[model samples]
Target: MALLPAAVPALRAENLSKRFSTTLAVDDLSLTVPTGEVFGFLGPNGAGKSTTIRLLLGLLRPTHGAAWIFDDPVADVARAHRHLAYVPADVALWPAFTGQECLDLLAGVGPGTDLAYRDELVARFGLEPGRRARTYSTGNRQKVALVAAFATRAPLLVLDEPTSGLDPLMEREFRRCIAEAAERGQTVFLSSHKLVEVEAVCSRVGILRTGRLVEVAGLEELRRLRRTEVTVDLSRPAPRLRGLADLPGVTDLRWASGLQFTLSLVGPPGPVLRALGETDVARIDVREPSLEEIFLDYYGEVSA
Candidate 1:
Protein backbone atom coordinates (compact mmCIF):
# COMPACT_ATOMS: atom_id res chain seq x y z
CA MET A 1 0.00 0.00 0.00
CA ALA A 2 1.18 3.54 -0.83
CA LEU A 3 1.05 6.42 1.66
CA LEU A 4 -0.69 9.67 0.76
CA PRO A 5 1.10 13.03 0.57
CA ALA A 6 0.33 15.87 2.98
CA ALA A 7 -1.99 18.66 1.87
CA VAL A 8 -0.51 22.10 1.12
CA PRO A 9 -1.67 25.48 2.44
CA ALA A 10 -4.13 27.56 0.47
CA LEU A 11 -1.73 30.54 0.32
CA ARG A 12 1.75 31.45 1.59
CA ALA A 13 4.04 34.45 1.33
CA GLU A 14 7.61 34.56 2.58
CA ASN A 15 9.08 38.03 3.09
CA LEU A 16 7.25 39.35 0.04
CA SER A 17 8.12 42.93 -0.95
CA LYS A 18 7.37 45.26 -3.86
CA ARG A 19 8.92 48.60 -4.75
CA PHE A 20 7.99 51.28 -7.30
CA SER A 21 10.32 54.15 -8.10
CA THR A 22 11.03 55.64 -4.65
CA THR A 23 7.98 54.32 -2.79
CA LEU A 24 8.01 50.85 -1.22
CA ALA A 25 4.51 49.57 -1.79
CA VAL A 26 4.84 46.29 0.12
CA ASP A 27 7.67 45.48 2.51
CA ASP A 28 8.81 42.17 3.89
CA LEU A 29 5.25 40.87 4.28
CA SER A 30 4.87 37.24 5.29
CA LEU A 31 1.59 35.37 5.74
CA THR A 32 0.20 31.86 5.63
CA VAL A 33 -3.49 31.10 5.19
CA PRO A 34 -4.35 27.49 5.91
CA THR A 35 -6.52 25.44 3.62
CA GLY A 36 -10.31 25.75 4.18
CA GLU A 37 -10.16 28.97 6.23
CA VAL A 38 -11.66 32.38 5.54
CA PHE A 39 -8.84 34.86 6.12
CA GLY A 40 -9.15 38.66 6.02
CA PHE A 41 -6.58 41.24 4.86
CA LEU A 42 -7.53 44.49 6.60
CA GLY A 43 -6.26 48.05 6.11
CA PRO A 44 -7.36 51.51 5.09
CA ASN A 45 -7.24 52.79 1.50
CA GLY A 46 -3.73 53.36 0.01
CA ALA A 47 -2.22 50.99 2.57
CA GLY A 48 -0.73 48.76 -0.20
CA LYS A 49 -3.54 46.22 0.11
CA SER A 50 -4.23 46.27 -3.63
CA THR A 51 -0.55 46.11 -4.50
CA THR A 52 -0.08 43.09 -2.28
CA ILE A 53 -3.00 41.31 -3.89
CA ARG A 54 -1.57 42.03 -7.33
CA LEU A 55 1.73 40.49 -6.28
CA LEU A 56 0.01 37.35 -4.99
CA LEU A 57 -1.95 36.99 -8.24
CA GLY A 58 1.22 37.45 -10.32
CA LEU A 59 -0.19 40.59 -11.95
CA LEU A 60 2.80 42.36 -10.34
CA ARG A 61 6.01 40.56 -9.45
CA PRO A 62 7.53 41.07 -6.01
CA THR A 63 10.83 42.89 -5.72
CA HIS A 64 12.30 40.83 -2.86
CA GLY A 65 10.28 37.70 -2.03
CA ALA A 66 7.79 35.11 -3.23
CA ALA A 67 4.25 33.76 -2.77
CA TRP A 68 2.55 30.49 -3.61
CA ILE A 69 -0.93 29.10 -4.06
CA PHE A 70 -1.51 25.52 -2.97
CA ASP A 71 2.26 24.94 -3.18
CA ASP A 72 2.42 26.33 -6.74
CA PRO A 73 4.74 29.34 -7.02
CA VAL A 74 2.84 32.45 -8.14
CA ALA A 75 5.65 33.16 -10.58
CA ASP A 76 4.22 30.29 -12.59
CA VAL A 77 1.01 32.16 -13.44
CA ALA A 78 -0.86 29.46 -15.32
CA ARG A 79 -0.24 26.73 -12.78
CA ALA A 80 -0.80 28.89 -9.68
CA HIS A 81 -3.94 30.48 -11.10
CA ARG A 82 -5.52 27.12 -11.85
CA HIS A 83 -5.90 26.61 -8.10
CA LEU A 84 -7.51 29.99 -7.35
CA ALA A 85 -10.22 32.28 -8.63
CA TYR A 86 -10.00 36.09 -8.25
CA VAL A 87 -12.53 38.95 -8.19
CA PRO A 88 -10.88 42.33 -8.22
CA ALA A 89 -12.15 45.57 -6.61
CA ASP A 90 -12.99 47.05 -9.96
CA VAL A 91 -13.98 44.31 -12.37
CA ALA A 92 -13.46 44.96 -16.09
CA LEU A 93 -15.50 43.04 -18.64
CA TRP A 94 -15.52 43.04 -22.41
CA PRO A 95 -18.03 45.64 -23.58
CA ALA A 96 -19.17 43.68 -26.58
CA PHE A 97 -20.25 40.61 -24.67
CA THR A 98 -23.62 39.99 -23.02
CA GLY A 99 -23.67 39.21 -19.30
CA GLN A 100 -24.25 35.54 -19.98
CA GLU A 101 -21.58 35.56 -22.64
CA CYS A 102 -19.09 37.12 -20.24
CA LEU A 103 -19.86 34.46 -17.65
CA ASP A 104 -19.46 31.80 -20.32
CA LEU A 105 -16.08 33.20 -21.31
CA LEU A 106 -14.90 33.35 -17.71
CA ALA A 107 -16.05 29.78 -17.08
CA GLY A 108 -14.20 28.55 -20.15
CA VAL A 109 -10.98 30.30 -19.16
CA GLY A 110 -10.94 29.17 -15.51
CA PRO A 111 -10.08 25.71 -14.17
CA GLY A 112 -13.78 24.77 -14.18
CA THR A 113 -17.21 25.82 -12.91
CA ASP A 114 -20.48 24.19 -11.88
CA LEU A 115 -23.02 25.12 -14.55
CA ALA A 116 -26.07 24.41 -12.41
CA TYR A 117 -24.70 26.47 -9.52
CA ARG A 118 -23.70 29.23 -11.92
CA ASP A 119 -27.25 29.54 -13.21
CA GLU A 120 -28.60 29.48 -9.66
CA LEU A 121 -26.18 32.25 -8.64
CA VAL A 122 -27.31 34.28 -11.63
CA ALA A 123 -30.84 34.23 -10.24
CA ARG A 124 -29.87 34.64 -6.60
CA PHE A 125 -27.71 37.67 -7.33
CA GLY A 126 -30.56 39.18 -9.36
CA LEU A 127 -28.24 39.75 -12.31
CA GLU A 128 -29.75 40.52 -15.70
CA PRO A 129 -27.65 38.11 -17.67
CA GLY A 130 -29.25 39.02 -21.00
CA ARG A 131 -28.00 42.64 -20.92
CA ARG A 132 -24.83 43.68 -22.71
CA ALA A 133 -21.87 44.22 -20.39
CA ARG A 134 -21.40 47.82 -21.55
CA THR A 135 -24.85 48.87 -20.28
CA TYR A 136 -24.54 47.50 -16.77
CA SER A 137 -24.06 49.71 -13.71
CA THR A 138 -21.08 49.31 -11.40
CA GLY A 139 -23.10 47.21 -8.98
CA ASN A 140 -24.51 45.04 -11.75
CA ARG A 141 -21.05 44.54 -13.22
CA GLN A 142 -19.82 43.49 -9.79
CA LYS A 143 -22.64 40.96 -9.58
CA VAL A 144 -21.48 39.29 -12.77
CA ALA A 145 -17.94 38.87 -11.48
CA LEU A 146 -19.18 37.67 -8.08
CA VAL A 147 -21.54 35.13 -9.64
CA ALA A 148 -18.75 33.79 -11.80
CA ALA A 149 -16.14 33.64 -9.05
CA PHE A 150 -18.40 32.00 -6.46
CA ALA A 151 -19.47 29.31 -8.95
CA THR A 152 -15.90 28.37 -9.89
CA ARG A 153 -14.57 25.01 -8.69
CA ALA A 154 -11.21 26.53 -7.73
CA PRO A 155 -9.78 25.67 -4.34
CA LEU A 156 -9.10 29.28 -3.29
CA LEU A 157 -11.17 32.45 -3.81
CA VAL A 158 -9.40 35.81 -3.66
CA LEU A 159 -11.75 38.76 -3.36
CA ASP A 160 -10.70 42.43 -2.94
CA GLU A 161 -13.31 44.92 -1.68
CA PRO A 162 -15.96 42.44 -2.75
CA THR A 163 -18.93 44.42 -1.40
CA SER A 164 -17.92 47.76 -2.91
CA GLY A 165 -20.81 48.20 -5.28
CA LEU A 166 -23.40 45.99 -3.62
CA ASP A 167 -26.54 47.03 -1.79
CA PRO A 168 -27.17 45.91 1.80
CA LEU A 169 -29.41 43.01 0.74
CA MET A 170 -26.88 41.76 -1.76
CA GLU A 171 -24.15 42.10 0.82
CA ARG A 172 -26.06 39.64 3.01
CA GLU A 173 -26.23 37.30 0.04
CA PHE A 174 -22.47 37.64 -0.42
CA ARG A 175 -21.94 36.66 3.22
CA ARG A 176 -24.09 33.59 2.67
CA CYS A 177 -21.98 32.62 -0.32
CA ILE A 178 -18.80 32.95 1.73
CA ALA A 179 -20.29 30.75 4.45
CA GLU A 180 -21.24 28.14 1.87
CA ALA A 181 -17.77 28.23 0.29
CA ALA A 182 -16.12 27.64 3.67
CA GLU A 183 -18.59 24.82 4.34
CA ARG A 184 -17.55 23.21 1.03
CA GLY A 185 -13.88 23.30 2.17
CA GLN A 186 -12.82 26.16 -0.12
CA THR A 187 -10.45 28.84 1.14
CA VAL A 188 -11.37 32.56 0.87
CA PHE A 189 -8.88 35.43 0.99
CA LEU A 190 -11.02 38.51 1.63
CA SER A 191 -9.35 41.93 1.42
CA SER A 192 -11.26 44.94 2.68
CA HIS A 193 -11.17 47.92 5.06
CA LYS A 194 -14.78 47.34 6.07
CA LEU A 195 -14.67 46.14 9.67
CA VAL A 196 -18.21 44.80 9.47
CA GLU A 197 -17.36 42.69 6.45
CA VAL A 198 -14.30 41.14 8.08
CA GLU A 199 -15.82 40.70 11.54
CA ALA A 200 -18.75 38.87 9.99
CA VAL A 201 -16.80 36.17 8.14
CA CYS A 202 -13.14 35.96 9.08
CA SER A 203 -11.91 33.77 11.91
CA ARG A 204 -8.51 35.46 11.75
CA VAL A 205 -7.31 38.79 10.32
CA GLY A 206 -4.04 40.43 9.28
CA ILE A 207 -3.67 44.15 9.92
CA LEU A 208 -1.48 45.93 7.36
CA ARG A 209 -0.03 49.41 7.85
CA THR A 210 2.31 51.39 5.60
CA GLY A 211 3.57 48.41 3.56
CA ARG A 212 4.14 46.23 6.62
CA LEU A 213 2.20 43.44 8.25
CA VAL A 214 1.58 44.87 11.70
CA GLU A 215 -0.45 42.13 13.36
CA VAL A 216 -2.32 38.92 12.67
CA ALA A 217 -4.59 37.27 15.23
CA GLY A 218 -8.03 35.94 15.93
CA LEU A 219 -10.77 38.60 16.20
CA GLU A 220 -11.49 37.81 19.82
CA GLU A 221 -7.83 38.26 20.73
CA LEU A 222 -7.71 41.55 18.91
CA ARG A 223 -10.76 42.73 20.81
CA ARG A 224 -9.03 41.89 24.05
CA LEU A 225 -6.20 44.26 23.22
CA ARG A 226 -8.60 47.20 22.86
CA ARG A 227 -9.67 49.28 25.84
CA THR A 228 -13.24 49.09 27.02
CA GLU A 229 -14.98 52.33 28.09
CA VAL A 230 -16.84 52.22 31.40
CA THR A 231 -18.97 54.90 33.05
CA VAL A 232 -20.29 54.88 36.57
CA ASP A 233 -22.68 57.22 38.39
CA LEU A 234 -22.74 57.52 42.12
CA SER A 235 -25.67 58.16 44.48
CA ARG A 236 -25.38 60.53 47.45
CA PRO A 237 -21.81 59.76 48.49
CA ALA A 238 -18.97 58.90 46.12
CA PRO A 239 -16.53 56.15 47.05
CA ARG A 240 -12.86 56.77 46.40
CA LEU A 241 -12.19 56.23 42.67
CA ARG A 242 -8.61 57.22 43.48
CA GLY A 243 -7.86 53.60 44.32
CA LEU A 244 -9.39 52.50 40.99
CA ALA A 245 -6.90 54.77 39.22
CA ASP A 246 -4.21 52.42 40.58
CA LEU A 247 -5.95 49.25 39.40
CA PRO A 248 -4.46 47.27 36.54
CA GLY A 249 -5.87 47.92 33.06
CA VAL A 250 -7.48 51.14 34.28
CA THR A 251 -6.57 54.42 32.60
CA ASP A 252 -7.96 57.83 31.65
CA LEU A 253 -9.84 57.99 34.95
CA ARG A 254 -12.07 61.04 35.03
CA TRP A 255 -14.65 62.32 37.51
CA ALA A 256 -17.48 64.73 36.78
CA SER A 257 -20.00 66.54 39.04
CA GLY A 258 -18.48 64.85 42.11
CA LEU A 259 -20.63 61.80 41.42
CA GLN A 260 -19.86 60.42 37.94
CA PHE A 261 -16.72 58.44 37.15
CA THR A 262 -15.38 57.23 33.82
CA LEU A 263 -12.34 55.15 32.93
CA SER A 264 -10.83 52.94 30.26
CA LEU A 265 -10.42 49.29 31.14
CA VAL A 266 -8.01 47.15 29.13
CA GLY A 267 -8.04 43.75 30.84
CA PRO A 268 -10.45 41.80 33.01
CA PRO A 269 -13.37 43.69 34.54
CA GLY A 270 -13.59 41.67 37.74
CA PRO A 271 -11.26 43.91 39.68
CA VAL A 272 -13.10 47.07 38.67
CA LEU A 273 -16.46 45.49 39.41
CA ARG A 274 -15.33 44.50 42.89
CA ALA A 275 -13.93 47.97 43.53
CA LEU A 276 -17.17 49.56 42.32
CA GLY A 277 -19.11 47.31 44.71
CA GLU A 278 -17.77 49.40 47.62
CA THR A 279 -19.12 52.63 46.04
CA ASP A 280 -22.65 54.08 46.12
CA VAL A 281 -23.49 53.27 42.53
CA ALA A 282 -26.59 54.69 40.86
CA ARG A 283 -25.98 53.68 37.25
CA ILE A 284 -23.17 52.08 35.28
CA ASP A 285 -22.60 51.54 31.61
CA VAL A 286 -19.88 49.49 29.97
CA ARG A 287 -19.38 49.87 26.25
CA GLU A 288 -17.26 47.55 24.18
CA PRO A 289 -15.23 49.32 21.51
CA SER A 290 -16.39 48.85 17.95
CA LEU A 291 -14.27 46.88 15.48
CA GLU A 292 -13.53 50.09 13.60
CA GLU A 293 -12.22 51.62 16.81
CA ILE A 294 -9.86 48.69 17.33
CA PHE A 295 -8.69 48.84 13.71
CA LEU A 296 -8.04 52.55 14.00
CA ASP A 297 -6.13 52.03 17.24
CA TYR A 298 -3.59 49.98 15.31
CA TYR A 299 -2.88 52.92 12.95
CA GLY A 300 -3.06 55.76 15.51
CA GLU A 301 -4.16 58.14 12.75
CA VAL A 302 -6.00 58.07 9.44
CA SER A 303 -3.84 57.41 6.39
CA ALA A 304 -3.59 59.91 3.56
Candidate 2:
Protein backbone atom coordinates (compact mmCIF):
# COMPACT_ATOMS: atom_id res chain seq x y z
CA MET A 1 0.00 0.00 0.00
CA ALA A 2 1.19 3.48 -0.86
CA LEU A 3 1.69 5.71 2.20
CA LEU A 4 -0.12 9.02 2.34
CA PRO A 5 1.92 12.17 2.68
CA ALA A 6 2.23 13.56 6.18
CA ALA A 7 0.24 16.71 6.81
CA VAL A 8 2.17 19.92 7.41
CA PRO A 9 1.62 21.60 10.76
CA ALA A 10 -0.15 24.93 10.64
CA LEU A 11 -0.10 25.45 14.39
CA ARG A 12 1.99 23.60 16.99
CA ALA A 13 2.03 24.00 20.77
CA GLU A 14 4.43 22.34 23.19
CA ASN A 15 3.91 22.32 26.94
CA LEU A 16 2.36 25.78 26.75
CA SER A 17 1.43 27.24 30.14
CA LYS A 18 0.36 30.65 31.39
CA ARG A 19 0.06 32.20 34.84
CA PHE A 20 -1.70 35.26 36.29
CA SER A 21 -0.44 35.83 39.81
CA THR A 22 -1.55 32.75 41.74
CA THR A 23 -3.95 31.54 39.05
CA LEU A 24 -2.68 29.13 36.42
CA ALA A 25 -4.73 30.27 33.46
CA VAL A 26 -3.34 27.58 31.14
CA ASP A 27 -1.65 24.38 32.20
CA ASP A 28 0.97 22.47 30.28
CA LEU A 29 -0.86 22.25 26.99
CA SER A 30 0.49 20.67 23.82
CA LEU A 31 -1.33 20.12 20.55
CA THR A 32 -1.01 20.47 16.81
CA VAL A 33 -3.37 21.48 14.02
CA PRO A 34 -2.43 20.19 10.60
CA THR A 35 -2.76 22.36 7.53
CA GLY A 36 -6.26 22.50 6.01
CA GLU A 37 -7.91 20.74 8.96
CA VAL A 38 -10.74 22.30 10.98
CA PHE A 39 -9.75 21.58 14.58
CA GLY A 40 -12.24 22.27 17.36
CA PHE A 41 -11.06 23.50 20.75
CA LEU A 42 -13.85 22.82 23.24
CA GLY A 43 -14.31 23.62 26.90
CA PRO A 44 -16.67 25.13 29.48
CA ASN A 45 -16.28 28.70 30.70
CA GLY A 46 -12.79 29.61 31.99
CA ALA A 47 -11.33 26.37 30.68
CA GLY A 48 -8.27 28.20 29.26
CA LYS A 49 -9.57 28.13 25.69
CA SER A 50 -9.21 31.90 25.37
CA THR A 51 -5.89 31.93 27.15
CA THR A 52 -4.54 29.24 24.87
CA ILE A 53 -5.68 31.20 21.83
CA ARG A 54 -3.98 34.32 23.10
CA LEU A 55 -0.81 32.37 23.60
CA LEU A 56 -1.01 31.02 20.07
CA LEU A 57 -1.59 34.56 18.80
CA GLY A 58 1.34 35.83 20.85
CA LEU A 59 -0.90 38.29 22.72
CA LEU A 60 0.34 36.76 25.99
CA ARG A 61 3.75 35.36 26.80
CA PRO A 62 3.67 31.74 27.83
CA THR A 63 4.97 31.10 31.32
CA HIS A 64 6.55 27.93 29.90
CA GLY A 65 6.78 26.06 26.59
CA ALA A 66 6.28 27.47 23.13
CA ALA A 67 4.00 27.64 20.09
CA TRP A 68 4.51 28.11 16.37
CA ILE A 69 2.48 29.22 13.40
CA PHE A 70 3.59 27.57 10.17
CA ASP A 71 6.88 26.80 11.93
CA ASP A 72 7.35 30.47 12.85
CA PRO A 73 7.64 30.96 16.60
CA VAL A 74 4.61 32.74 18.08
CA ALA A 75 7.10 34.79 20.08
CA ASP A 76 7.66 36.54 16.75
CA VAL A 77 4.10 37.88 16.73
CA ALA A 78 4.41 39.98 13.59
CA ARG A 79 5.81 37.14 11.50
CA ALA A 80 3.35 34.54 12.81
CA HIS A 81 0.37 36.87 12.31
CA ARG A 82 1.39 37.39 8.72
CA HIS A 83 0.15 33.89 7.97
CA LEU A 84 -3.05 34.01 10.02
CA ALA A 85 -6.28 35.92 10.72
CA TYR A 86 -8.31 36.01 13.93
CA VAL A 87 -11.96 36.69 14.75
CA PRO A 88 -12.76 37.27 18.41
CA ALA A 89 -15.93 36.27 20.28
CA ASP A 90 -16.78 39.90 20.96
CA VAL A 91 -16.01 42.03 17.92
CA ALA A 92 -15.27 45.69 18.40
CA LEU A 93 -15.06 47.96 15.36
CA TRP A 94 -14.16 51.58 14.86
CA PRO A 95 -17.50 53.34 15.21
CA ALA A 96 -16.37 56.33 13.19
CA PHE A 97 -15.63 54.28 10.07
CA THR A 98 -18.04 52.88 7.54
CA GLY A 99 -18.15 49.10 7.17
CA GLN A 100 -16.40 49.37 3.84
CA GLU A 101 -13.74 51.56 5.37
CA CYS A 102 -13.08 49.04 8.11
CA LEU A 103 -12.80 46.26 5.57
CA ASP A 104 -10.40 48.28 3.46
CA LEU A 105 -8.29 49.24 6.46
CA LEU A 106 -8.09 45.66 7.66
CA ALA A 107 -7.19 44.40 4.20
CA GLY A 108 -4.52 47.06 3.83
CA VAL A 109 -2.95 46.10 7.14
CA GLY A 110 -3.23 42.34 6.83
CA PRO A 111 -1.00 40.23 4.64
CA GLY A 112 -2.08 38.65 1.34
CA THR A 113 -5.75 39.77 1.40
CA ASP A 114 -7.77 39.10 -1.74
CA LEU A 115 -9.97 42.11 -2.61
CA ALA A 116 -12.04 40.13 -5.14
CA TYR A 117 -12.74 37.49 -2.50
CA ARG A 118 -13.58 40.21 0.03
CA ASP A 119 -16.25 41.59 -2.30
CA GLU A 120 -17.76 38.14 -2.69
CA LEU A 121 -17.74 37.66 1.09
CA VAL A 122 -19.45 41.02 1.62
CA ALA A 123 -22.26 40.00 -0.74
CA ARG A 124 -22.61 36.52 0.74
CA PHE A 125 -22.63 37.79 4.34
CA GLY A 126 -25.30 40.41 3.47
CA LEU A 127 -23.19 43.21 4.87
CA GLU A 128 -24.00 46.86 4.27
CA PRO A 129 -20.64 48.28 3.37
CA GLY A 130 -22.01 51.87 3.34
CA ARG A 131 -23.24 51.82 6.94
CA ARG A 132 -21.05 53.17 9.73
CA ALA A 133 -19.81 50.60 12.25
CA ARG A 134 -21.94 52.20 15.00
CA THR A 135 -25.10 51.62 12.95
CA TYR A 136 -24.43 47.90 12.54
CA SER A 137 -25.88 45.40 15.02
CA THR A 138 -23.79 42.88 16.92
CA GLY A 139 -24.27 40.24 14.30
CA ASN A 140 -23.37 42.66 11.55
CA ARG A 141 -20.13 43.58 13.32
CA GLN A 142 -19.33 39.92 13.55
CA LYS A 143 -20.02 39.52 9.84
CA VAL A 144 -17.58 42.30 9.07
CA ALA A 145 -14.83 40.54 10.99
CA LEU A 146 -15.71 37.19 9.47
CA VAL A 147 -15.65 38.60 5.97
CA ALA A 148 -12.23 40.08 6.56
CA ALA A 149 -10.82 36.84 7.88
CA PHE A 150 -12.40 34.45 5.41
CA ALA A 151 -11.65 36.65 2.43
CA THR A 152 -7.98 36.66 3.25
CA ARG A 153 -5.69 34.03 1.75
CA ALA A 154 -4.21 33.37 5.19
CA PRO A 155 -3.00 29.88 5.96
CA LEU A 156 -4.57 29.76 9.42
CA LEU A 157 -7.84 31.16 10.85
CA VAL A 158 -8.33 31.39 14.61
CA LEU A 159 -12.04 31.82 15.31
CA ASP A 160 -13.24 32.28 18.89
CA GLU A 161 -16.99 31.53 18.96
CA PRO A 162 -17.31 33.10 15.52
CA THR A 163 -21.04 32.50 15.24
CA SER A 164 -22.06 33.83 18.65
CA GLY A 165 -24.19 36.66 17.28
CA LEU A 166 -25.40 35.09 14.03
CA ASP A 167 -29.00 33.95 13.57
CA PRO A 168 -29.77 30.43 12.43
CA LEU A 169 -29.74 31.38 8.76
CA MET A 170 -26.47 33.25 9.05
CA GLU A 171 -25.00 30.55 11.22
CA ARG A 172 -25.64 28.08 8.45
CA GLU A 173 -23.90 30.44 6.09
CA PHE A 174 -20.93 30.63 8.47
CA ARG A 175 -20.62 26.86 8.51
CA ARG A 176 -20.72 26.78 4.74
CA CYS A 177 -17.99 29.37 4.56
CA ILE A 178 -15.83 27.35 6.97
CA ALA A 179 -16.21 24.26 4.82
CA GLU A 180 -15.21 26.27 1.80
CA ALA A 181 -12.18 27.62 3.63
CA ALA A 182 -11.07 24.13 4.57
CA GLU A 183 -11.53 23.03 0.98
CA ARG A 184 -9.24 25.86 -0.05
CA GLY A 185 -6.46 24.47 2.21
CA GLN A 186 -6.86 26.80 5.17
CA THR A 187 -6.49 25.54 8.75
CA VAL A 188 -9.24 26.67 11.13
CA PHE A 189 -8.75 26.57 14.89
CA LEU A 190 -12.27 27.04 16.22
CA SER A 191 -12.79 27.60 19.95
CA SER A 192 -16.43 27.24 20.88
CA HIS A 193 -18.98 25.84 23.35
CA LYS A 194 -21.31 25.09 20.42
CA LEU A 195 -21.06 21.32 20.22
CA VAL A 196 -23.42 21.13 17.26
CA GLU A 197 -21.19 23.38 15.20
CA VAL A 198 -18.10 21.39 16.12
CA GLU A 199 -19.76 18.07 15.36
CA ALA A 200 -20.99 19.37 12.05
CA VAL A 201 -17.71 20.83 10.82
CA CYS A 202 -14.66 19.67 12.76
CA SER A 203 -12.69 16.54 11.87
CA ARG A 204 -11.19 16.33 15.38
CA VAL A 205 -11.74 17.97 18.75
CA GLY A 206 -9.71 18.73 21.88
CA ILE A 207 -11.49 19.06 25.20
CA LEU A 208 -10.15 21.32 27.93
CA ARG A 209 -11.05 21.22 31.61
CA THR A 210 -9.97 23.86 34.12
CA GLY A 211 -6.85 24.75 32.10
CA ARG A 212 -5.98 21.13 31.35
CA LEU A 213 -6.48 19.28 28.08
CA VAL A 214 -8.29 16.11 29.10
CA GLU A 215 -9.11 14.58 25.74
CA VAL A 216 -8.34 14.94 22.05
CA ALA A 217 -9.74 12.66 19.38
CA GLY A 218 -11.69 12.38 16.15
CA LEU A 219 -15.50 12.64 16.43
CA GLU A 220 -16.04 8.91 15.93
CA GLU A 221 -13.34 8.09 18.47
CA LEU A 222 -14.90 10.46 21.01
CA ARG A 223 -18.36 8.99 20.46
CA ARG A 224 -17.01 5.60 21.52
CA LEU A 225 -16.32 6.98 24.99
CA ARG A 226 -20.10 7.27 25.54
CA ARG A 227 -23.00 4.83 25.14
CA THR A 228 -25.40 3.76 22.42
CA GLU A 229 -29.17 3.92 22.92
CA VAL A 230 -31.09 0.86 21.82
CA THR A 231 -34.84 0.60 21.43
CA VAL A 232 -36.20 -2.92 20.88
CA ASP A 233 -39.70 -3.91 19.83
CA LEU A 234 -40.88 -7.46 20.42
CA SER A 235 -43.15 -9.30 18.03
CA ARG A 236 -44.87 -11.10 20.91
CA PRO A 237 -45.03 -10.67 24.66
CA ALA A 238 -41.43 -9.73 25.55
CA PRO A 239 -39.41 -12.66 26.78
CA ARG A 240 -37.68 -12.02 30.07
CA LEU A 241 -34.38 -10.37 28.99
CA ARG A 242 -32.62 -12.25 31.74
CA GLY A 243 -29.07 -11.03 32.50
CA LEU A 244 -29.27 -8.66 29.52
CA ALA A 245 -28.85 -5.61 31.74
CA ASP A 246 -26.12 -7.44 33.61
CA LEU A 247 -24.03 -7.53 30.43
CA PRO A 248 -20.88 -5.41 30.54
CA GLY A 249 -22.10 -2.59 28.30
CA VAL A 250 -25.81 -2.39 29.13
CA THR A 251 -27.43 0.14 31.44
CA ASP A 252 -30.74 1.93 32.26
CA LEU A 253 -32.97 -0.88 30.99
CA ARG A 254 -36.60 0.18 30.89
CA TRP A 255 -39.78 -1.40 29.57
CA ALA A 256 -41.75 1.35 27.88
CA SER A 257 -44.65 -0.92 26.85
CA GLY A 258 -45.52 -4.62 26.73
CA LEU A 259 -43.66 -4.92 23.44
CA GLN A 260 -41.16 -2.06 23.71
CA PHE A 261 -38.08 -1.45 25.84
CA THR A 262 -35.09 0.90 25.80
CA LEU A 263 -31.56 0.36 27.05
CA SER A 264 -28.19 2.03 26.73
CA LEU A 265 -25.12 0.04 25.73
CA VAL A 266 -21.60 1.27 26.43
CA GLY A 267 -19.20 -0.93 24.45
CA PRO A 268 -19.15 -3.39 21.59
CA PRO A 269 -22.50 -4.58 20.27
CA GLY A 270 -21.52 -8.25 19.76
CA PRO A 271 -22.87 -9.44 23.14
CA VAL A 272 -25.97 -7.27 22.97
CA LEU A 273 -26.75 -8.42 19.42
CA ARG A 274 -26.42 -12.10 20.30
CA ALA A 275 -28.81 -11.65 23.21
CA LEU A 276 -31.31 -9.78 21.03
CA GLY A 277 -31.02 -12.45 18.34
CA GLU A 278 -32.38 -15.10 20.74
CA THR A 279 -35.66 -13.18 21.19
CA ASP A 280 -38.52 -12.65 18.75
CA VAL A 281 -37.09 -9.35 17.70
CA ALA A 282 -39.49 -7.35 15.54
CA ARG A 283 -37.50 -4.13 15.25
CA ILE A 284 -34.45 -2.63 16.83
CA ASP A 285 -33.19 0.94 16.73
CA VAL A 286 -29.67 1.86 17.78
CA ARG A 287 -28.29 5.39 18.09
CA GLU A 288 -24.74 6.42 18.86
CA PRO A 289 -24.25 8.96 21.62
CA SER A 290 -23.89 12.54 20.44
CA LEU A 291 -20.77 14.65 20.91
CA GLU A 292 -22.53 16.57 23.67
CA GLU A 293 -23.12 13.36 25.61
CA ILE A 294 -19.50 12.35 25.21
CA PHE A 295 -18.37 15.81 26.30
CA LEU A 296 -20.55 15.62 29.36
CA ASP A 297 -19.12 12.25 30.29
CA TYR A 298 -15.54 13.55 30.13
CA TYR A 299 -16.55 16.77 31.85
CA GLY A 300 -18.18 14.90 34.71
CA GLU A 301 -15.06 12.82 35.19
CA VAL A 302 -12.82 15.91 35.17
CA SER A 303 -15.07 17.72 37.61
CA ALA A 304 -15.11 14.73 39.93
Q: Supply the global lDDT for candidate 2.
A: 0.85
> Which lDDT value does model 2 have at 74?
91
The numbered model that scores best in lDDT is 1
> lDDT per residue, candidate 1, 142-230, as tens digits?
99999999999888999999899999999999999999888878899999987768888999999887788888989896555568899
Off by over 4 Å in 2: 1-8, 225-250, 253-296, 299-304
Give lDDT tens digits, candidate 2, residues 81-169.
88888998889999999999999999888766778888988998899999999999999999999999988888888999899899998
- Report, for every candidate in turn, its global Cα lDDT versus the true structure: 0.87, 0.85
Error of 1 at 208 (Å): 0.7
